[model samples]
Target: MKPGTSTQSALPKLVTCPTCGGDSVYAPSNPFRPFCSERCKNIDLGAWASEDFRMPTTGLPEDQKTDDEQ
Candidate 1:
């Protein structure tokens, strides 16, 4: 164990890819952290671009206006 050296560098952290649900290296060594491969990363990007993934909203009706508008 050398000074300023961390044990984290010795072993790669394993994580599940969001797109494929597979094991992925969550480290700088892997260009695609949290993703198994570029293919999986790209697929996630495509889903975002196509609006397949969405954030939860309050579901306010279009007819109703916000207080800011008043």
Candidate 2:
């Protein structure tokens, strides 16, 4: 054990930004991690807000759907 040591790991992990496909720091030091920058983060956010990213759904009507579909 050393004096004045941190519990956090010394090495930070690097990850690919989803929006820009660039390298990003996956640590607390990077506020907009996993997205590279605010622009890329916002772009991803906008996509979500605009319903561009969604889960797959069946094209059946709600009334015709079975109990499993609910």
Candidate 3:
């Protein structure tokens, strides 16, 4: 341990690339490190735009029936 080394300098214990799933240096302070680069981030965005990711929703009512419909 170097005298100038601060405890905060320690990198993330887990080394994993979130996007490409390749070797990556994890950091608690890094925002895009897991993605490796911005390109990966865009890929993820495209997936959502193309409906690759679907989220369930209650959705709007289709029929205008009364609340007391038997």
Per-candidate total of colliding backbone pairs: 0, 0, 0
- Winning model by lDDT: 1
RMSD in angstroms between candidate 2 and the native structure over all alpha carbons: 5.6
Q: TM-score for candidate 2, please give it.
A: 0.68
| Per-residue lDDT of candidate 2, residues 1-70 (tens digit) | 7998866677688999999899999988899987789999999999999999999986877569778866
- For model 1 the TM-score comes to 0.70
TM-score per model over all chains? 0.70, 0.68, 0.46
lDDT of 3 by residue, 1-70 (tens): 8797779556454566656886665665656666656787788778888998888887557775566764
Deviation in Å, model 1, residue 67 alpha carbon: 11
Of the two candidates 1 and 2, the one with more favorable TM-score, higher being better, is: 1
| Whole-model lDDT values for every prediction | 0.91, 0.88, 0.69
Q: After superposition, how far is residue 69 of candidate 1 from its true place, in Å?
A: 12
Model 3 stretches with alpha carbons more than 4 Å out? 1-9, 12-15, 28-31, 55-70
Q: After superposition, how far is residue 12 of candidate 3 from its true place, in Å?
A: 4.3
